[model samples]
Target chain A: MDILPQLILNSIIAGAIYTMIALGFNLIYGTVKFFDLGYGALTAVGGYSVFYFYKTLGINIYASIILGAIIAGIIGFIVYKLVYTPLRTRKSSGMVMLVASLGVLTAAQAIIAIIFTSQFQTLSINAGTERVFTIFGGVITQTQLITLVLGLGIMIVMALVFKFSLFGKAIKAIGDDEEVSKIVGINTNKIIGWVFFIGSAIGGLAGILIGFDTGIEPTMGLSLLLKGVIASIIGGIGNVYGGVLGAFLLAFIENFGIWKISGEWKDAIAFGVLILFLLFRPQGILRR
Target chain B: MTKTAKGILWVIALVIVVLIIVNVSSKGGKNSNTASSTPIKIGFTGPLTGDVANIGQNAKAAVEIAVGEINSAGGINGRQIEMVYEDDRCAGPEGVKAANKLINVDNVTAILGSVCSPATLSFAPIAEKAQTPVLSYCSTAPKISESGDYIFRDVPSDLFQAGFAAKYTYNTLGKRKVAIINVNNDWGLGLKKAFSDAFKALGGQVVLEDGDDPTSKDLRTQMAKVKSSGADLLYFAGFPDGTVAGLKEAKTLKLTQTIFGADAWDDNKIWDSLGSSADGVMYTRVGTNSSDAFKTKMKEKLGNDSIVYCSNYAYDGLKILADAIKTAGTDRTAVKNALYSIKHVNGVSSSLIEFDANGDPKEANYVIDIIKNGKAEIVK
Candidate 1:
């Protein structure tokens, strides 16, 4: 009975982490309508930035975090301009775009590995193990709590902006029909560039928080992206609310699934759920 | 055929022919007869590139130093040694290619190398078939024991380290119940199985056992089960990245059980990443008896970041091969026989270096070390 609460807590924490990733993934997919695989490697960019600034250079941690996100955003924007924008101009197929994004992903991951040496690095100066809380008999660390709050907080903020803002309408118009969006003087490329910056910033922030919680590694991007992609697919690839729901659902199922079976099967269980969603409910919980 | 395609094929053919000719002439220029002033060809294969290249590079440095020392000390029975280096790049296919070249091309009498276990395992069969003896310096996998009669490793196997860990956790630490979580990879499964089997043999109860993906950073699912396991000790068999995550999550869950690790936990980066949360965590690793003299010599040769734990064994491995060659001459079978006959010899790695029937080092000392304030201290 006591274990149940902790299992739920663990699921919530895991879900929150995935939600950070899925939120950014959905935000980008919603706008561009192409799976931006390079979005994954941007997480490492954020983490390494913080590692260099806060850990190595002895900068203020908060300031370092802001710089990390901004740098990731700028990098994301540059990648879009350099690689993705040309593809968009050519009106390339989604397959071509996906492959291009994969190139971006591979190059970015390699660059980060070259800079950081592919070893696991910790960004948390304070290990954060000391500051722990037990809520409803479920233990949660300060970093984890921050992760949960920020996940939901960012989701709500993005939801409101999408519902009421001009930029949000522009994004939806481009997503619905890029040709129509461009014809309406929406500046599809510029809007998509900003979308890339915003989405990648969120991804970067997820990386920073994850670094504080569990440390960072260059190759972590792929797995992080994988979980988020699964969540986005299950919730509805382009729907933000669907991504959140799918993330929590996936997390809950994964945590509870492994509770009965051995822990070795956790990833197996996750992939199994992904397969189930793909087969039975391909459109996910909400149809875009 | 297309003109461009015909030209490309011709170019490839020419390159292959040129490579073979160059290879033959190089060896012919170096050595003609089996004796006299000809250098004894010894082949070395290891991941001289890629992520774990540092380990291979350290081994290379140690081998180079050994080669220098042996030559300076009037050579191995007056025949100077020449090392043919091949960069395996830590891949299995690469290892096989390197092994083939070392055997068929360079015609090395003995092979010393291949730091990674996969590479060693991959090339062992080819070397065994070719009657070329291989001595691994850094591969600690128990799987290598069955690799071939011609294959031998100076490093103690993970099975030995795991048994030591299990015994230490059960008898020395006086822990009865243990919860083990390991990576699903070969290294993890091999060590984990060895541990559970040994622990069970000792009448210790394993309350929970699970394997995790090597790349996974989140272990809360496993940790949740472990929290309720009521085990006195938690055993982790993993590399550094996973260890950092496991320790941090374990700390967050606030589990009161003592965390124990296998040989993999000897990494300094794990402790650095975990910080104070790593305090009280203990691990059993194959202890080395690297002398101040050896350390000083290594520093003078290659500077800092050169003295990896594996380098100690690498130094000993090269010396063992050289000693075997000196006794039995350059005959591969004689060298193999010499290795089996060779008994206790004190070297940089440990107090004793003796090969058993399986070509594994007979004497292995496991040191129990504990983390305190984010740093490791030998507790035993």
Candidate 2:
């Protein structure tokens, strides 16, 4: 019953979740070069969509997850087309885009609150019969285990795509320089649109998993987004592999920091690390 | 100018001037001397829209039922009781505004409401300044005991609950080392302090203590610390959302210590979602022994079988206010005096309530309940 094993297990579970969010956020930030606050709302949208399909409409849970991810992807695409794309055409500043994204986040959260009545909802259908597995003196539920596996699988696939896929090359070109990518016949708009969909779909998967692991709330998105943003920044923003590394590091730091202190200091410890990084190593642990 | 035309215009203007003066005077007179048979206005403030809206709305429904029963029986002193409800949204600023509106605009003699402790604390000063008696049905922060002489609540503060829980854990359950994890809020902090004080007084050691933001969903880090503390029991103080998440995480970590909680865990929604995971968890709640007749009435009214404990307190709060008005008339000061001295008031919580020097219930019967098969059963 060494507590170290349990603490490590908890850190890994949290790190897995943060990795999913940070990867998607880093991918989008690399190309867009702007903070999409609306990304948080999409997390809620993904969870609620599955809740509607599986719980309300009686669809199969696995199928509902696919549909929910697709719906989130489409919504992300629509937001780009309607808001960001138009703003880009108008030559708006990044600040303007950030503000617009905030507006979208607020409106989306309000809509979800109205529809879901601001009540905490669990997405599990078999919460009562769910089984627990012990590993190295630490316990984990099935959903958490799946979360770890999903995080690893996604990271491997993303790394391979970045290395080999033509679509990935197009994305990198655009991220390097959008104007030059267009002149080089990279079809920047189409490639960026695809990036948004894929990134948002990954974010949606994270949301769905979170809903199963804990529960869903309208305001859950903002906190999740904050953690992801922190991970991306500390991991070297826009660096895909670095984002994953930063996520696990943050998870470990936060969990261990509270090992001998009050849990109320958890958030303070996170921001303290962020501030330290900004002050001493502005380039983060892994500089691009 | 023609003489007849000027004369007619002057007469019409005079008539209009006289009508305005009469109307203004009558409006002022009506407010000063409200008719005896007119409805006695009572203002209610609670969260009808935000996070804790469920509790607020439930309390409102129960109070309305009590109002209906009172009015049908020809209300106190042959006057009907009318309730004006304001949505505080469970925030401090919102509660302040609601209290002002209820006092200044609505001109109510008494106010019932504000389920959340922060909201109640925010509005208590305003009610005291206005000399309006405010009875909170659910707010249980220990600070409320000394908030104001005019501020009252039917529900006992967390002091009683914490003391009960501490004794139960130390004596009945025979757990010596205890760890505490609480949400950082008025309710949580109050219980945390009270329980810690009581536990230490009973010669039990507090091994570790921590606080979490109410909005935080993850408690694994805190659970890890709790597990390592070598504590035989864990006392978690939080509302339903945080509690459910914390419990799930503890179960995942296989923290086998007994978990103790406050009344916030009385929520059925949490138990239903938790399923078998909630089994064997114990919590202390104000014993609500509502009659079958009341349950049937609440079911027919709310379209549900379950009525939260706060709703019963709210129902009793209205009855107590009416009884006070009957005994001391509608004058705010007289009603306050009567409330301060009110004795042996029968409430649905299976307790006879009498205000102490500080306006809290002098004594409350706290019952320990254990969850079994997704239902909370009172431990005998």
Pick by lDDT: which candidate is best?
2
lDDT of 1 by residue, B78-175 (tens): 88888989989666889999999998878898899787777898999999998888999877778889888889988899889889988888898899
Query: What DockQ do you compute for every candidate structure?
Result: 0.48, 0.45
lDDT by residue for model 1 (A1-288), tens? 268889999999999999999999999998888999999998999999999999899999999999999999999999999998888889899999999999999999888877777677888875745588988888888888999999999999988988999988898888899898888899888889999999999999999999988888777788899999999999888998999999999899989988877777878888998999999999999977
- Candidate 2 residue B326 Cα shift, in angstroms, is 4.7
Model 1: interface root-mean-square deviation in Å: 2.7
**Which digits, one per residue and each the tens of the lDDT, describe model 2 over residues B1-380?**
79999999999999999989977854643363257867888889988876677788888888989999999999988999989899897778999999998888778889997788988999999899889999899999999999998999989999999999999999999999999999988889999999999999999999999989878888987887888789999999977888878888887776779999998887888888888877899999988768787888888888998788999999989888999989988888888899988874456765588888899988888899999987899999
Q: Any idea how many clashes model 2 has? A: 0
Where does model 1 exceed 4 Å of error? A128-130, B1-61, B71-119, B126-132, B300-307, B325-337
Q: Give the distance in Å from residue B84's predicted Cα in candidate 2 to where it truly belongs.
A: 3.3
Error of 1 at B246 (Å): 0.7
